[model samples]
Target: MIRTDDTRYALRPGVTCLTVPGGAVLLNPPHNEKLAGLTPAQSQALKTLNQGPATASALAAESDSVTTLLDRLAGAGWLEVTVRDGDRDLYTLRPFSTPPARPSTGDGPRTVLSKFTVIHRDPDGLVLEHPTSWCDFRVHDPRLLALAAGADPTELGLPESLSARIAADLRWGGFTADPAAEDLDFTTRSWSAPDLWFHRRSTLGSRTVTWDNFGPTAWAKDEFPQRPAHRPAYPGAPIALTAPDLGALRATDPALTAVLEDRRSCRSFDDARPITLTQLAELLYRSARTRSVETSPDGAELPSRPYPSGGGVHELELYPVVRTVEGLAAGMYHYDSFEHALRLVAPADSIAVQRLLRTTTATLANGAEPQLLLLISARAGRVMWSYKSVAYANILKHVGVLMQTLYLTATAMRLGVVAQGFSDTAAFTAATGADELEECNVGSMILGTPGDRPRTTD
Candidate 1:
């Protein structure tokens, strides 16, 4: 018998035994091996026997009178039984011991200290360096100490006597020890040395003042206070371009009113059920695509829609990740709004769909996947070349209008809807193959069957 901590044992050919805590042993049988000699009743009885020690009467009761074969096997010496008090079955087997301990190295104490070095310095005295760690130390000339104290030295917590000493020395003469000293040491010995003195220039000549002892009396009160609070002044006059409240606009336009009343962020969805192809077509047609073409006197064509864009560019493009839409393959498809059709872009597995949706939004409940995921991208350069700031703001406003349209349509159809804006922008851009020019992601939406609707109260 092998006796060691964390040891492996072969129970049979290609089979092994694993010992766990509390002296419990687990038999891991091989795929090809089977208990060929034992009958079904005997096999079931053995399984019960291995659970714990038990008397013959107790074993029969527990195994439903299936222990007759167990007694026969024990008489044949194939199985060893040990009798104990009170209702426990015991099996005799060889015992094992614990392993020995290993030696260890006994090294003395150690510590880690942070370090910093000056990397660059400008003529204006602005210094830049990559510190090993951030510290609460001020870097300033000694002459400025007195002025800094008057402002708010309580925040810095340096003693008043130290500030006065630095001010008197720097303003009157300068550093007394050596004017050419480049490296200043501030160790415990140097701080306590009697040689440390301040040299000053009087009207007569130079003079020196010596102190009995000079070092930090106690730990400097280094709990620096935060800066005073401030609040920006409010503008006295009204500003233009502020968004109108949705409730106010709803009273005039019935379409906008429908959207404002029905919009909600839904999560739970019905898995087996999905939206029909006809419903998908209607959603795409209403939110995007050209419903009717209008011709100008100069023969210029324009799409009839409420969503406004800069110079009627209509640069937003849509991509759909279809997982459970009826009559549609489970994969990614680009929505050609102009053509009013879905063009198959690539085949995506369930894992890929989960990854894409997780990066963009929260997971759907009950492992319920979305029927359709909409990706909106903007052709920025097309609009930016003609209109600058107007193009940027117009693109975002168009997305908002599109979301409202989707919400109202989904509500009318009794379907779930969600708009997600927090996404891995770079990953989505790469996956869509829309990186030509400056294509930017605008928004995303998930649509599926609504599981349960909350009851309305009067």
Candidate 2:
């Protein structure tokens, strides 16, 4: 059995004890309101926590009055408890996001590690963390780490005392799974670990867990300088695109309802009557062109486009990989939305480019190949520069918005368009000579002349 006397307690990380005119106020901003009205003795006791963890017996010996306050704070999760053996700390239960509910008492079912639990190195040597967990366990002992890593006490041949201690720590951290809960719910059973983790972190579920650092925090500005308004212009002779007259098109364009109803994923294309360069230019202009560039209050350039993006961080860039078009050469060209032009990145017959097109053709599952394959990439740093955890999720959302915009626009122009659900980053990187981390493809779509009888796969 684990000894309670060996447990040492301290204030949770990020919690501060303030000296007020009365007793003292415990301030954990964004998590709790000021916990005011404490006696001088209680405040003094809480202050001693800053020095480090102390046992209840030790604290009680110093001042008997401090015991009640310590127990209250520990129960409320304002205090973190560490199990110690001499100088070595076995493990520490640190409250991170929410006020932790006390672990269940008494022996329960046979335990297995939760599938969602992850052990990663942070400032602390190795931390056992879960996205939906109210607290994280800072593991110091290898024995405990092994237990968290899915070692059974019997298999590890750990001493009974040490095994019991590790098991208690595991219970406190909720590292074990609840098979009953998992088996009972269909939705719970269906969720993969990564999807559940992503869903939990990207959206705010609880005020106690999630901080108010949402939207345009500019979290990375200090570490990395803000990226320029536009990516550096691609090398090669730029292809000047035709900017269609908005006034003329406004009077002649299809109605919104007609375009919406006509929108479908068209897999078949007419190679005989391929889309002309002028038509391609109009499509790009109408769907993805930068209307105007303006500076944010924080001095970052925000480009307004036909589609909406999170924090106006228009990170998405277009590269049209062409196979056949009446007026344009067969090549992969970067769409310069700001300048309304294209810069050739790769030849049409390049092995890498052809491989990417071939993959899409196979994915399309039709006899036809894409006449014009548009690869949509994201300058991830643009959004990451401003936002924190939600950067990638926001990028995916932007991709979806742009896809819909492309769909409607292509439908109006009576062109065949099909949004591909998957893309090959390696093929794209090889074709464009771009770093995957710096700028990688997030989405892809195929566009061409609508066949006499277009095959729809909506």
Candidate 3:
């Protein structure tokens, strides 16, 4: 949850709402407006009721005469009886607390200590206890604590006695642990390129025990592939296209032109009609498979195509999530652009395809069963071999360019196209079998027949 200076609460993306104290309840009139006249006694009663539900007799003890004030506040539209328990009138505060303040920190901080677990393990086996949730220890920093309390830890730093006292207070206050040795076993493992360490501890009877220093080891060196063993093997048969296809695609219909001109990012799709295999084949051929090859004067090979890729590396590969395409079984298939055919990776009904597509925002906006989805992945080292830090950006640019081509082509072919930016990168890489390579997800585009025309801001 990100907090703002104004004390407004934001729990997650697109979810912003007012937060009140635990016991306090919010009350607002049918229409929002200021309460015209609220007496001091009435206001005090409301504040007291905010602590918890209370009867007039209970409220009267906390504040002034509850009956007179409660009646006045209710008449003034400042308070409402939220619930009735026995004879007590539970009044809710009329206006909610102000929006939370903007958070001073953005993106917050990375976890310093992670996956902390207490385990009782003997040579025989191990039993895991409650896993410690990652907590920010920076709050225990003397400097920060002092600042929070409107004092200066720095000034006290020179005085050893005062500093020790403050440290003691902080330790006992649950902000930090008391200075002691903790007994722990450190285990490290490699996840992706980074090595992760897990700290294990066991309590023996009641005696306090501690281990020496325990922390993550220096990051292990990344072992990247020297070269990619796999190469695109061109198909023996020529990718076929017909004259009627070109004519039908070239026809100028506003909707069709919008599809062509609209490029990628079609949020609304028509699910009534099934996308034909011919249309799917056309899209796959244009975006995934190579259209033509060119040779330089020196005899170096080049691709003649609709997209501009860095160094003509053609690092991008397509994985299709086939949901409701005619003549195609539902499954997760890797488009063998070289073979010009779909290689079944997992059954369409298999959870693997659902899991992979679930990682994408497209699945949320459009239903999980879109007509077709194109998962674009890149061979990292393939592009990185020619480009360095810029490789990441270059590969993404290549995806964008290719998506534009795909969108335009889909539009011309009277199909819906949506480019999705939000996806679970790690999941995508794993599903596409590109996680091992420096390979990463470039982007994803969902296509189907156009449904309802989307409402446009422009």
The RMSD of every model to the true structure, in order and in angstroms, is 34.7, 3.2, 22.6
Put down candidate 3 lDDT per residue, 207-326, tens digits, no spaces.
112121111111111444333323443234332432135355455435645654455456566667878767788887765566666654533344545578766667777777877787
Which structure among the candidates has the greatest lDDT? 2
Error of 2 at 293 (Å): 1.9
Order the candidates by lDDT, highest first — what do you get?
A: 2, 3, 1
Q: In model 3, which runs have C-alpha deviations exceeding 4 angstroms?
A: 1-264, 293-302, 360-368, 453-458
**1 or 2, which is superior by TM-score?**
2
Using Cα atoms with residue i matched to residue i, what is each candidate's TM-score against the true structure? 0.41, 0.87, 0.45
Better of 2 and 3 by TM-score: 2
Residue pairs clashing, model 2: none
Q: After superposing candidate 2, which stretches have Cα over 4 Å from the reference?
A: 1-6, 19-24, 30-43, 50-58, 61-68, 97-109, 153-159, 178-185, 207-214, 365-367, 452-457
TM-score of 1: 0.41
Please, what are the lDDT tens digits per residue for candidate 2 over residues 1-458? 23255678887877787765556666676656454666667666666776767776656524545766766676666888787666567778787644555566577777777777777898668887766676778887776666665677555555567667667666656676766776678976788778877776677664234444655578787778877758789888789999999899899999999888878888777889999999999999999999999997767788999999887879999999988988999989999999999999998889998888887866454656788999999999889898866888999999999999999988888898989889888999999888899898999999998776656758
Error of 3 at 414 (Å): 1.5
Per-residue accuracy of model 1 over 1-458 as CA lDDT, tens digit each: 11121111112212222322222233322122223345455454455556543445444423433444543333222332332212221112111111112112244222111122221333424221212111111233333333323333222344464433333322212111221231255542343222121111111111111111112111122332211111111223211112223375345435656656766777666666787666676667656764455554533344555466545556677767777788676766666555566766556754544566665435455445567887777766545544422455667777887777777767655667887765456655656555646677788888887667442210
